[model samples]
Target chain A: MPDAGITAFADWIATTSLSHLIAQKLWAIPAIQSVHIMSLAIVFSSALVVDFRMLGLMSTGQPLSAIARRFLPGVWIALIFATISGLLLLIAEPVRSLPTWEFQGKMLSLLCVIILTLSFQKLIAARAPAWDAMPGVPAGAKLAALVSIVLWILIIFGGRWIAYHAG
Target chain B: MSITEFLQALESTAFATAVREGAILFPFAESLHVVALAFVIGTVVFVDLRLLGLASRNQPVTRLTNDLLPWTWGAFVLAAITGLSLFSSTPERYFTNTFFRWKFFFMFLAGVNMLVFHFVTQKNVKEWDNDPVPPTPARVAGALSILFWACVIVFGRWVGFTL
Candidate 1:
C-alpha cells in the first residue's frame, strides 16, 4: 500500500481538471500509449544494436564507437518522446498509476536502465579503440551489455504488469 | 462447423479460458508480445533509416541487413507466437474488432513489402550497397515498411480500446 502522503498526492492529482479532461477523452489514453510504445521501440532497438556490437554478435568489424555514435542519439531522442507520452499517461490516471506497486517498480527499473545505459556509453567512449583492436570485445563490456539487455527486458515486463496489478 | 461456432469453441477451450481468466497468464503473454514487437520494430526501423540515408550512412546496406536480419526474424517469430496466444484468449472479441482487422491487414502489407524488397529491389544490392542513399526501389520499400509497421502498432493499441 502507498503511504498516506503518496495517496493524498494521487488523490489530489486525480481531481485536477487536466486529469478530468484526459479521463473524459476516450482516445487520449490509447493515443498517448501508442506514442509511448513507438518511442520505446526506438530506444530499445537502438540499445540492442549497441549491446549486440559490444557482445560481438554483430558488426564486429565496425568500431564500437561508430556503432554507439550511430545508435545512441536515436536512443536519447526516443527517450525524450517516451518520457513525455508516459507523463501524459500518468497525468491522465494518477490514482490508477501513482499508487501501484507495479507502477513504482517499473519507474525504479526505468531509472536503473537509464543509468546503466549512460555508464555503458561512457565505457564505450573511453575504451572503444582498445576493445575494437582486440580479437574480441572485453568480458567486462560484454557483461555490461548483458546487464543492460536484462534490465530493459525487466522494464518492459514491469510496464505491462502495471496494467494488470490492482491500482 | 460454422466460423462462429469454431471461434466459440476455441474460446471455450481450457487453455483459452485459463489465459482469459487466470491472474497472470494474459498479462505475461501481453508483456512478451510487446517486448518481442519492440525488437521487431526496432530492428526494422534501424534498417529503414539506413535505407533512407537517415542514419548509419557509412555502413554498407547489405552488411547491416545481414547483421540485423537474424535478430529481426527471431523477434518476429516471438511476436507472432505471443500474438497468436493473446488472440486465442479471446478470439471473438478480436475477430469483431475493426482495429484488430486493420492490424492484421497492415502486418500482411508489411510482409508483402519485405518480399518485394528481397525478391525485386535487392536483386541489384551490390550496385548501391555502398551508396549513402539506396536506390529508389529500396527507399520506397523502406518507407512502406515503416508506414505499415506504424499502422500495425497504432491499430494494435486501438483494438484494446475498441474491444
Candidate 2:
C-alpha cells in the first residue's frame, strides 16, 4: 500500500464504528475465529477440486474449464471471507502487525496470488476446452497454478510462524 | 533434570539422539508424512463439502472415498511418524501442554469420527448413492471432521505460542 493509502486506511479504521463494534464484546473474537476456520474449508474445497482434476482424479473427460467452473465460486467466497476475517484480525492488532515485516511479506505474496488469479483465468481453465483452446495451457499456465498453491501454503506457514516470530 | 533426560524418561525405549534427530533420517518416511497430510486434509475438505452438498454434483461418495483413501492413510502415516519424532523431542512438555493435550483429544475424536463414518454409516451410503445430498450420518461425520480439524489446527497454532 502507498503511504497515503496506509494513512487513509488507518484513519478510516480508527474513525469508524467498526472499532467500537469489534471492541464491544469477547464473543466477537470467536465469531471472527469461526469465519476464519469456515473459510478454510471453502477455499480448500475449491482448490482441491481443481488440483484433483489437474492431477486427473475426477471429471477426466470434462474439460478443465468445466471443472474449474465447477469450483471457482467456493474459492471466491473463501477469499472474501478470508479477507474480511483476516482484516478484522489484523485490525485487532494493527499496532503490532503494521511494523511486523512478516505480516508485510505475507500481504505482498497474497497480492501476487490475487493478481495472478485475475490475470490468467482463461489460461487456468484452458484445460476445460471451452476456451478458444489456445492450443494447450502453456508452461506458464501450470506455473501459475503451482505458484498459487505455493503462495497459499506459504501464507499459512507464515501465519503459524507469526505466533513465534511476531515481529 | 535436563530437557534431554526428561524427554528420554517420557519414552524410554529409544535413544534420545536417535529420536530427536528425525530431521537426520530425511528419508522416505518424512516424504510419506507430507504426502499423507495432503491426501487426508485435501480429501477431507472435498468429501466434507460434498456431505454439506458443496461440489461434484454427480459424483458418488464411494468413488470419491475410494480415490482419496490412499492419501488419507498416507497422511496418517506421516503424521504418526512425525508426531512420534515430534513427541520424542519434547515429551514432558507435550504431556503437560494444555494445547498439546487438546490436540491429542481432537485427533482421537477425528479418528473415531472417521471410524464411525466407515462402520455405522457405510451401510447407509448405498441408500443415498444416487441422491445428491448425503444422509444425516454422513453430514454429521463431515461436520465433525471439520470441527475436529479446526481444533487440531488451533491446537497446533497454540502449541507454538504456549510451548
What TM-scores do the predictions have?
0.95, 0.71
> What is the per-residue lDDT of model 2 for residues B1-112, given as tens digits with 9 covering 90 to 100?
9876766576665544465555443223333333345446656877787776666658777766665666567657777876666566557777789988898899899999
Quote the true-contact fraction of every model: 0.87, 0.07
Output the worst ten-in-a-row residue range by lDDT, candidate 2 chain A: A127-136
Question: Interface root mean square deviation of every model, in Å?
Answer: 0.8, 6.4
Q: Highest DockQ: give the candidate number.
A: 1
> Which ranges in model 1 have alpha carbons more than 4 Å from their true place?
none
DockQ for each model: 0.86, 0.19
Which is the leading candidate under lDDT? 1
Q: What is the TM-score of chain B in candidate 2?
A: 0.80
The global C-alpha lDDT for each of the candidates, from Candidate 1 onward, is 0.88, 0.64
TM-score of 1: 0.95
Grade the docking of candidate 1: high
lDDT of 1 by residue, B49-163 (tens): 8998887888899999988889889999999888888888999999999999999999999999999999999999999999999988888998999999999999999988887
lDDT of 2 by residue, A1-167 (tens): 46556646655665557766775655565567556755754665466556555545445555667657657766787789888998887676454455455667778877886676656555654434443233334565656667777776655555434434422
